[model samples]
Target: MAENTCVRCGAIPPSHDVVSVASADGSFRLLCSRCFNTEMADLAEVHAFEHPEFTPVRLSDADGVVHEFHFRSLLFGDQLSLEAFEPVPGDDDYAGFRFQVLGDPRSDPFELLGNLVQKMKRALAVKHLVEDAGHLVVAETTVRGRIEWDGNERDRLPCVVI
Candidate 1:
């Protein structure tokens, strides 16, 4: 594959970006953020949780099961809420299975991220992980969760990013 395009889409995104998805697969792939949020008739899908957002995280088990999770720093208040969702059959838009995690306001962000990544690494352990040009971690990582959306975005990863 070329050094500057998406593995899934086969085209490079414009200056408007998609996050450079990183994974333990040990190779790097450039990810097109726009591809995740393909041009939709609805703009509501664009913001993860309003701008300057908490990272919308994508997690999957090694078997490729994954889910979309969102964190609100609770407006940086005393608590944070993490929400997870699952996909409905034949529909990319999910019906809410609503999994929510509340955090201790004092926990460090990097620490939380590290914990999450380590768990992901373990979930994907020895299965697969790749970091290339167009996508982030294409890990066979335990993407045990599955998320759903409108499916309007054509280039979505096997798992949701955020």
Candidate 2:
């Protein structure tokens, strides 16, 4: 429909889980959680979760490819990052990330981070990367200066696909 609108369902209704997913044509669109998951269902894993900092978010899709999100500091430091690893063939090797954030440094080390909003958006970008293989592309190279990687298939698969 229009720019900044969901391609499948026009105009995002009021909600906080609106996500921007990549279109096959190599662009991005804003989709509500339902629509977003539907659009990406064939390509990756999509789920709702909160950052260790307690910010809520959801994401990924299933395709014959893989997607991952990378976050670089908007300011700089031992910035928090994310990843969804591959399932070891014929093994119960699952996929996941090392998600954590700090607010007061005394917040039990897990509180609403200093930049909650931006970091939440960045973590959301890490959602729904398909557990597949292929060439690597920066799905969202940067989120408010944080980088999101649709990162999968960076290296050759250890086993055959089919």
Candidate 3:
């Protein structure tokens, strides 16, 4: 058995928090949690020309009604593009929403989405309509909400937006 070292810092990470990243050539690099966070932060500044696989997210209201949305792609700046199929019957097209990632760029995008979903869950718990340009809303919410994107959902997390 051999110990893995952080590819960026060349230091050993704690057993619980090792992060692995795959390079363009298909080689893998291990990083300490700190180095991984740093790399994610740097990613925020650049456009992701190559899209990564994203999982769909499920959000529930206080009444136990669930809505599913899939991550489509990343746009310029800190915005993530998403699409939600109409949970209702006979609705063919997908509804779109632009989620603006706020706060520190050092946070993982998935983690940020999880956090947002948690916020929305809380709002739904209180019987509040979770609507906003930066948050989740239907096309009728505003002109911006009408934008659509094509893709499938890759990951699921519990989240809510305040």
Candidate 4:
């Protein structure tokens, strides 16, 4: 089957029927449906916080899953609140608020990313994790941390990040 690349992470679709949505503004150019939802929602959240006149609303897919979450801008020093509605089986309804003054972007990519993806999955009770490109990893019920650090074999490895 001819492969189609996901615009978000550049990973090819696993199946022919995988749905994808792309934006025309040259921002989110190419994204599979799943990734597109994630990215769009993130952008909406940022925009709502930045622009007060625009009231943000929830966005969902055909199945009515809460795919997008957004909130209106809050005043400085005012408390922000978040509340999630019904969550899917493998998903959780998350609610929280954060306030931070605009600052310069961090230079370290990993620093901006924070802890490794594996650690986050565990915290979220997620069982499946697709690493850079197409490396899929499943976590067992029991936590058995394994770090594959082969210092000498650099040439044979796939560059996970560009």
Writing each residue's lDDT as its tens digit, candidate 3 over 1-162 gives 236687788887444345577888999988765565556546766433333335566777667877665443233235443222223345323332224334333346566566666655554465434558778545333322233323334544433322
Candidate 3 local accuracy as lDDT? 0.49
- Over 4 Å off, model 3: 1-50, 78-89, 92-107, 128-162
- Summarize candidate 1's per-residue lDDT along 74-138 as a digit string, tens digits: 22234433333444555433353335445543555455545545554464444445667877564
Best of the two (3, 4) by lDDT: 3
Off by over 4 Å in 1: 1-52, 75-78, 86-99, 116-162
Q: Candidates sorted by TM-score, descending order?
A: 3, 1, 2, 4
Instruction: Indicate the worst ten consecutive residues by lDDT in candidate 2.
Output: 70-79
Report the number of backbone clashes for model 3. 16
lDDT for 152 in candidate 4 is 44
Worst 10-residue lDDT window for candidate 1 reads 39-48
Best by TM-score: 3
- lDDT by residue (52-133, candidate 4, tens digit) is 2222334443233333332222222222212112223442222221112221121232331232222332333433343555
Candidate 4, 151: how far from true, in Å?
52
Find the 10 residues in a row with the least total lDDT in model 4: 97-106
Better of 2 and 3 by TM-score: 3
For candidate 1, give the lDDT.
Answer: 0.45
TM-score of each: 0.27, 0.25, 0.36, 0.22
